[model samples]
Each structure stands twice: as C-alpha cells, then as structure tokens.
Target: MKLKFLGKRISGILAILPERELHFDDEIGNFNFSSSNSLKLKKIMGYGRHRLADDDTCISDLCIFGLKYLFDAHLLDKAEIDALVVVTQTPDYLIPPTSNIIQGKLGLKHDLLCLDINQGCAGYLVGLIEAFLLLGNEAFNKIVLLNADVLSRKVSKQDRNSYPLIGDAASITIIERDSVERGIFANLQTDGSRGEALSIPAGGMRMPASDSTAVLELDGDNLRSKNHLKMDGGAVFNFMQTEVPPMIEDLLNYAKAGKDDVDYFLFHQPNKFMLQKLTNKIGVSPEKLPSNIVENFGNASSVTIPLNITFNLGQKLKDQSYAVCLAGFGSGLTWSSMFLRMGELDFCKIVEFVNKGD
Candidate 1:
C-alpha cells in the first residue's frame, strides 16, 4: 500500500529503555556453541548488551513511565491528547488493550481515542502511519503513538539465535498538525505466505500455551520451546535483502525524492550485518545509514526505529529539521518505509526506566 499524508508532523519523541543491561559476553556460555564460534557470532552479528525488562516490568509499565516523564516535563499535556495509539507485539494482557490501560492509569479524558495495534519490527512506521490516519479525523488534534515490546520475556534464554539480540523498549511520539503542510509519503507490504519466517508458534488462539508447547526441544542447533520466538534466520535475511531495497526504491520514486535528498535512513536494527548488507544494496553510504543499534542496545523490535533516532540523532533533531527516510522490516513478514521531514521537536531523548520507589 502507498500512503500520503499532509499537515501532520511529529512534535516530540521520548524513548524509554529498560535499566537492566545484559552483556553478550556475560551470557555467551548460555548458547549452544563453542566459545570461539560464539565470539565469532558476536563479532559478525554485532552482539553486545541488550536491555531486558526485569521480570516484574510489563509493556504498560514502560509506556506509563515514559508518558509520565513527558507529562511531568510539560512537553506533553494530557488534556490536549486526542488519541493514544500503541503498537506492540507484546501486550500486558490478552484483554484490556494496553492503550486503554495507559489512559486509565494516567486518568486521561474519556473523549480520547485509545487503540492497540499488533505489529512488529515495522511497528514504528506502522504506528506513525496509524497516527497520521487518526489525525485525519476532525475530532483529533494530538496523538500519542507508543511503540513498545518486551520480547525478551518471550524468547528462550537457551536460544542462541535470538537471545543475545532481543531487547525491550518503548517510545512515546507526539504527533499533531503541521502548519507548513509538508507531505509524508510511505509504503507498506506484507507476505503472510512467509509469516512463519518470524513468529512465536504457540501463544495465540490457534495454539494456546500449554505444557507441550513449553517443552524445550532441539530446533536446529538450539533448544527452544514453541512458546519461544522462532526465526528462520536465513529466510528472513534473504527476504529483507530481496524485498527491502526495491520497496525503498519504489517509495523514494513515489515521493519524487532522490537518495541524496535524504539526510539519514533510520532503519530498523535487526543486526549489524543485515543492515550493512541492505545499505550496500540500497547504494547508500554506511554513515548515512546507522547499523550500530544492535551493538549498543540490541534490536528492540519495532521500537528500534524510534530508539535509533533518539539515541543517534536526539540532539540534532531537537533544534533542526531534516529530510529523512525510515524503514522497518520483520515479524509478520512485513516491511514498511516512510519519507518525511522530521525534527525540531519539543523533546527527543532516551531515559532509563527507573522503578518507582527504587
């Protein structure tokens, strides 16, 4: 799908990362690989420390904490918010949407719209798209788009493929009308035929969680249960390399933009290797496309895009505007990209999630 939106711009961004940092070396022995092989994987995949929410922390916790920070800073006014949109693969519950949970916890107005979108990897782009759409309604003025995931809690600690790179994070983005009337161009594609390329096989309705699903069995070279995140690494890599560059080309063409017109390509961070390869195929310089998020903070699912911005370009974004391209691809076999003028925000920073009373 191709989408175009006008008169909508993001005013602020706040990314909250878990305080708990687990280093790759500390957990190297947990993987089923020789030390030399594990070290090789780390060097190749850009494995470093990843943030994982403590057992007690939930998706709602991060969102509430980040939202309150904005509220307290006066960067955002609760009363001015017309909608709350949360995009996450990990919800606090199967019922009572996390958006509603956040609104109620903060005691926001009843007239506001609260919606939850189930998406992954491409979530930041997905969330922005949904936020833009919601702004089309005359009733909505300000929308808070929250992209969060605590998928470390979903993956098996014994699984070498995903454990070292899984991270937890939440981003609070404030989007509202732009007086300048700039156009935001975007495109989204999904291939459910290859959905299993990245999925958790036994958590939802089709196959409810059970003892059988929880049994650890050998999956390739790793031991993982059906309840854990399952990824066909090779398949996903091939899919991204084959699909993303063309999708980005189409998006740039649709927006009548040349590659040089973009100041930065803020893409989802799956790993350092994949991003560099994608950047090569896209014919952009490595400096224009950052791939260090995995090495610094691991891949926090959809939050990676916002996390990338806040972590790498927060200072610049706070005072200057830039023409940027954003892309996120993963789970759902989904790939999405957006071209927009973003920056000059009220706030753009990352805060560590500190527990209350700690």
Candidate 2:
C-alpha cells in the first residue's frame, strides 16, 4: 500500500493566547499542598471571544478563522471543497458535530462530506489515515483536514495539577492525491483495558449534563475544582515507557526503514520530561527530534503533530524521509502510531514572505 507523496499543501494556520495566565500553586493556606512541595506556575491558556472580535464566538470561531486563511492561501477561486474532516474532542457542539459547523461557516457546497473524529490526541494521525484512504480512491482530488481543540475550555482551573499544562490552538491541512510519495504507512494500536490513564470524566453520553450531576466548583482563581483533567501520572509514565519505543521500532521495520533513516522524530508533544524519556529510551539523538512545544503551546491535542510539521520542521530538511510517529495515549488509553515520508517543499519561500511581514 504505497502512496506517492505528491507534494502536500497547507492553507490556514493561526494560533491565539488567552488573556488570563494561570500558574501552579504548591502551598495551600500556608501549608505545602503540592506533591513537590514547591509552587510553580503553569500557563492556563485559551482564546476568548474578545480576541475574535465577536462575543458570541466560541473556540470553534478561531478554527474557522484558521480554515478561511488556508482557503485563501491556496488561492481557490470560489471552488467548492469536496470533503471536510474535523478531528477534535472538544468540538463546538455535542449534537451536530463541529465539522458541520465548519462546513456551513466556510460555505462549502452541500454535497461536501463532513464528519468529526473524537480520537483525542491520536485524532490527527487517524484522521489523516481516513483522509488518505478516501482520497486514494482516485475519486476525490482535494480534501481538507482540520485539527482544532480548545483544551483550556475543559480544564479545571482549580485543579493545580492539570491547570498549568493544557493549552489551546487550531491547524488546517489540505491533502490531495499526487504521485510524490509522502503520505502514511499505517501502524495503529490500542489498549482499552487501561483506558482511564488520562481523561475528562463528565460531559458525555456516559454522564450527560444535569443539575444534580454536581456543578464543578470554581475557586477564587476562576479554576474549576471538580471538572479538572485527571491523570495517573505515574501510571501514564509506566505505560509510555513500555508501549511507545517498541511501537516505533515495529513501525520503522514495517516501513522498510530504521532509526537512522528518519530525518527527525516527531512524536506527540506530551511534555518536556515525557519526550526526553521517550527519546532516550528509543535511542534517538536530541538533534534528530523535533522541538516539543509544550512549554509555550502546551498539549494541543490533535493539532500538536501538524503544528510541529508546520512551524518546527517547515522546510529545513528536504528530500529526507521524516518518520512522523504519532503516539496519542490518554483518556480512553488509546494510542496509535503511523510513519510518513515527508518530501521537501519550497518552505523557504513561504517563510521568507511570512517573516518579511508581507
């Protein structure tokens, strides 16, 4: 199942930071409450409606803005896009799905195929696989895959443990069928038995919204006491150590490549510590790995992978095979990894104009 990497194109790309920044507190009422016994600040990141210039706008609005920018960049002259796939867990609405909203806002033709995948961090890789499968049929020529999530919206502000780590952002990628050789070698896996390693417990069919369902208490800092993100940090670390490296090895073997063949390793941007551990365990040198945006952008869920490719990788390496191993393990305890060969594009031109402030 070889697909030519016929030059992929990206359109709209935008990121915004919220006004309020939340930091981690170690002391609770003159007593050390933090596990580390030290107070450190984590950025509580989000983009409000004020930033969008419309109070009625939600996080999805920022996504819309990014999507429009991509369409314009592609220079499509009023052409109707064939398909729209939105990979997001924190969608704008629960019932109608965010893809439908995006489709309407973009004024895509009625015949457009629109859907949403609720695969959390692994969503982008899985979504890309779906898009590739659909586009590979030779029937559809162009497809738009959008990965956007405002994770800060769901984060519990009062949960000092999680409040400082989550951030929000959106990204859009336009995929088309071409004869170039830079798509994907699908290698995906999951373990539902250990699913709750990381997750948001409320606000789903399993536990729908209700008054008696206990309103999440908000502390003085505007952080929620009850609705915060929960994770067994140690358990997750253990799982990562055991699962990620071998998967990478297997994927490389399946793709007919090796650790030394990859131009750079772009795994899920979990955090600095986790990334370091994974890299060391996998025997990948620091220079060969992409920069982790956790410090500034935090975990953008599905957008992390694309953001790395767009902002970090850019056009630095050309004609090099990039082994992009996307491992998303959290919430449902689901994880998936896929290797893709990224060909060189004229990123210098794109960056020159963007940097020149044009």
- Candidate with top lDDT is 1
TM-score of each: 0.99, 0.79
Task: For candidate 2, give the lDDT.
Answer: 0.60
Q: After superposition, how far is residue 27 of candidate 2 from its true place, in Å?
A: 12
- Residue 58 CA error for candidate 2 (Å)? 3.0
Q: Residue-wise lDDT of candidate 2 within 1-358, one digit each (tens)?
A: 2232334433323343333333333223322244343233222222111111122335457566655544567644226467878887777787788888877776777877887887777777777777777775655667777777777666654554454556666666666655654445656667778777777666678866566444666443344433446666778879888987887888777778888877777777666677777889999897877545666456777767766666566555343334555555555665667766554542211110011111
- Specify the poorest-scoring 10-residue window by lDDT in model 1: 349-358
Q: Give the TM-score of candidate 2.
A: 0.79
CA lDDT, every model vs. true structure: 0.93, 0.60
